[model samples]
Target chain A: MAKELLKGNVAMAEAAVRAGCEAYFGYPITPQTELLEHMAARMPELGRAFVQAESEVAAINMVYGAACTGKRVMTTSSSPGVSLMMEGISYIAGTEVPMVLIDVMRGGPGLGNIAPAQGDYTQMVHGGGHGDYKTIVLAPASVQEAIDLTALAFDLADKYRAIVVVLADGSLGQMMEPAELPEMQPLKKQLPDWAITGEPGRDRRLLTSIYLQPEDEETTNIRLQRRWMEIEANEVRYQEYFLDDAEIVLVGFGTAGRVALSAIRHARAEGIKVGLFRPVSLSPFPAEALRLVARKAKAMLVVEMNAGQMLNDVRLVTQGACPVDFYGRMGGVVPLPDEILSEIMRLARFTPHDLNGHTRAAWLDRLEVVRGAK
Target chain B: MVATDIQNAKLVYERPESLADVATHYCPGCTHGTAHRLVAEVLDEMGIREHSIGVASVGCSVFSYNYFDMDFVQAAHGRAPAMATGVKRVFPDRTVFTYQGDGDLASIGMAEIMHAAARGENITVIFINNAIYGMTGGQMAPTTLPGMKTTSSPRGRDVETQGYPIRMSEILATLDGVSYVVRRSLHNPAEIRKSKKAIRYAFETQQRGLGFSMVELLSSCPTNWGMTPLDSLTFIEDKMVPAFPLGDYKVIDAVKSMKWKEG
Candidate 1:
């Protein structure tokens, strides 16, 4: 395989087309417009439809329509555009149509600057759209991971028949790295019989969230829960670095995870015996795997780009098994490896004997205050 | 029985098998029945029952889909054009069109309708300009005439307080993408024949793969207009036609030259 240097945004767009994306629709938004422009310039050449919609609302609806035809499709946007897309996202989830959404997150509660921020961690992982639904969120740490994980997103979407979100930040989208492109399988000409192609040779098919009757709504929720359980059981993905006989663990995802790797190496060089537990899938979050790893470590320090967003997931999985502590930087700035290493050193003071006094249960009690609020 | 007899009569211009044989819920002498018959007859004539997809918008005629023997999707207020654009783009081989009233198309969905035409999307739009919000108890509409009185504008519309009626056909004709734009009224036999010609043009344009085409039919809401069916027709001819003049505003017929090609 020949290697080519590609920006994270370009790599993601190529992966989508290689994954058999038949249509691409998006509006230009900061920190992610490169992906839209690339598709606009490339999709026409590939004989695929590409539309620069009037607004984020229009772009997502175009995706919704294209997806309903059972074609592989996708859309890209940043935080503000993603917010506008939530309405259509909710509708897509309700109808159980599988597609890809890439949110290259920028900062803020409103019009935040065009810099990398992991502030949307909670929104992507915790069902930001209005409904009882979950998007399979994959957080890529580098430009290479951007390509690999985006290809994986298409497979996961088709396998589970659900939305797969590739959540990255400006650093990952704008940064350049060498990538080995993966070949896609041949595309399907005809959709599955289940698709609503005008009720021909079958009864009328309805794709809507509105269930006037209570029982019908209950049945839909139950079906969604069953699918969620299957995904949790079989599809949780994560990466562990230098975990043999470590006393401390640094937990993170996305760009923060890349920073934590350096902090883990620095802690090891100082004989601090710290490891990294980086989650690759943020939705079916590696909860059980983290719980088992928690038994081996004396403490876990979660370094994040936001004010303790992923900390909630850390607490949920660990149940305070190893005295989970959070080190965070809010808004658009990313924390440095030195800062994370200092936090690890600050957390490594506890001996195994220290676990005997406070206990994991007591630490869990303290963590729940924020967890419950979230 | 009257509806069934109308469906059977060739002089009445309807498709018995392709149209839902069930009786219409529309009030007696209302033009909604005529509009529905015209659409059904066109579908039958074109032999596109299998390929046509209808978009029903939020209005008194929202249930128009129930009477059409074809696939249908109901859209939110003023969103039929957008949804129809989606369907047509997804299935380029299939014919997709939206059936919308004045309140749905001209008022709430003005932006979507205008943009869809401007984009020159390959879809047909059947716009029924009844000049009133029929589903919501006769409110003033964008197509409602100046000095028109209704439940909302009870004291008669004032040019200062209320804006003048919008001419959608003229507005759409100014677009680069729209291949055909025509406005016709369904007041008398002669005008109904003209409206049919406009509708047939839109349907044929779709079949021949033309760019965006729209036929704006000036219809009547007799129940909301507080007039008998005969008087409502007179009102449409006397009042609505002059405000929304009858004519074909645009026709491109260059759809074949605009084919998608991979570089």
Candidate 2:
């Protein structure tokens, strides 16, 4: 298909449709409303199911319902709305219903403003809902990535029989870019054997998350853990940029990762060895990849539009092989490329010679100064 | 002698084919089993049992899926209507219905049920209003009458403090999207028969492509009500009916002119 200038939200919505989403249920929340609006206008014309649910809670449950029929279903929301959907999402996870969810995230902690932020990194990666379950969390950094990832989300959801989340920030949701839309895939006409699609030529089917017995619930939890482990083994995704000869690395994802790429290019032009390690899947987080990068780099700077959420994961993977630093701007503040470039420059100054001299203590004192200022 | 007489007698009360042969988990004298039987009979009579999809709501009827011999999806508390809406919208040719409780429909799920009705979703809703939350032990439900003492309302449901009981059928009937809305009791055989007819009419409305149809049956939660099954039947007739009148709240012209057909 020809490339079209599309907003990220609209592109993702169209991509989901092309990916053969059979049903969409969502309420209007800023940053992500356009996706819901696009689906509203297009789904009915395509003869698919669409509902402007009364609330985010209702929308997710509707997706849960449609998913039970073994159909490709999805719902989208922003921060607070996603919080409202946690209960339904947990239920979908517990029942092992395959569906896609798009979280075009805005600022959080409350009814925060609708500006771009990577505040939901922990929530998405660590399972926001109640219970020990995991969702396939895909962080898309651009309009094109959003479109591609939203389509891939459905396939992954079905493959794992689990919820797949496309976690993008407000800027990615609102920005316009040229995207080559994928060709439409035909919808599946026959329901899967596990689907609850009326009982003719089959035994009666029931789909639920409830397990009254403790042992039964434990068995289900174990099965879910095994599936998650399998996903972790096979579905870890990341993008490496200019890492072949680099000594310093910039780690980020989503909008921040995109921003860090510009910083890395700027740093490279200045003769500073900085590369970018962008995680595409935040849940099965590219820990192994980061471990490899950590061994090659002298220092790593984790950039985010939140107060160092993904930094914790980066630190764990790096395991002190190299010093990992964090630069974040929270509450809807998008980190500037120059700011990240400066952080990269600061990391570059921590050479082996400087580590053995007063320059090391000076850098430590400067870090203390920075922390005190915050 | 009785066995010899039985061999010569006709069996008039065999279980409905649409009903699964599993033993119910309902408390003795609870009307959920009766309501389930009515829905199963209606589905069988219409011959839509094979194509019917039931969304079982979270409450006592959460396990209702196991008792019905059709594809069933169990929804989280009060989400049955929203779930049913999805199913019906996706498979418009198939029959879809939600079985919900008073707490599930009138309390936490109030928005889902109301919007589904207001949107005119082509589905049937079987609401059992037993004036208490049965599944979670006797707590005050949205339909709990004033001065009714339960676990949560130990001092009796103070009308000033706890608010008035919700008459869901009457409330839902006011919505323009509803094609049929009725409140029936299941306290006696005569009332049970009427309730079944109403259930049939509700399903027929859905089958005829009419808008939202719901039959709110005044059921008895004997264990939760702290009454024997026989006394609970009397409670529905004497106490519940006066508060929630037994009558058709709305019957749109399309539903009134409709005739039930064998699929």
| Candidate that would win on TM-score | 2
Error of 2 at A364 (Å): 14
TM-score of chain B of each: 0.90, 0.96
- DockQ for every model comes to 0.31, 0.75
At residue B135, candidate 1 shows an lDDT of 84
i-RMSD per candidate, Å: 2.4, 1.1
Please give the lDDT score for candidate 2. Answer: 0.89
Best by DockQ: 2
Model 1 DockQ, alpha carbons vs. true complex: 0.31
Per-candidate clashes, comma-separated:
1, 0
lDDT of 1 by residue, B1-263 (tens): 99998688776533544477888778887788787777777777767766777877788877876787776666656777776777677777788888999999998788778888989888899999999999888999988888999888998777798988889999999999898888888888888878776777787788777779999998989999999999999998889888888887886645323332211
**Candidate 2 local Cα displacement, residue A69, angstroms:** 0.6
Question: Candidate 2: where are CA atoms >4 Å away?
Answer: A351-374, B1-9, B261-263
TM-score of every model?
Answer: 0.85, 0.95
lDDT accuracy of residue A15 in candidate 2:
96
Off by over 4 Å in 1: A198-206, A350-374, B1-17, B21-33, B59-65, B74-77, B131-165, B186-190, B220-239, B252-263
- Candidate with top lDDT is 2
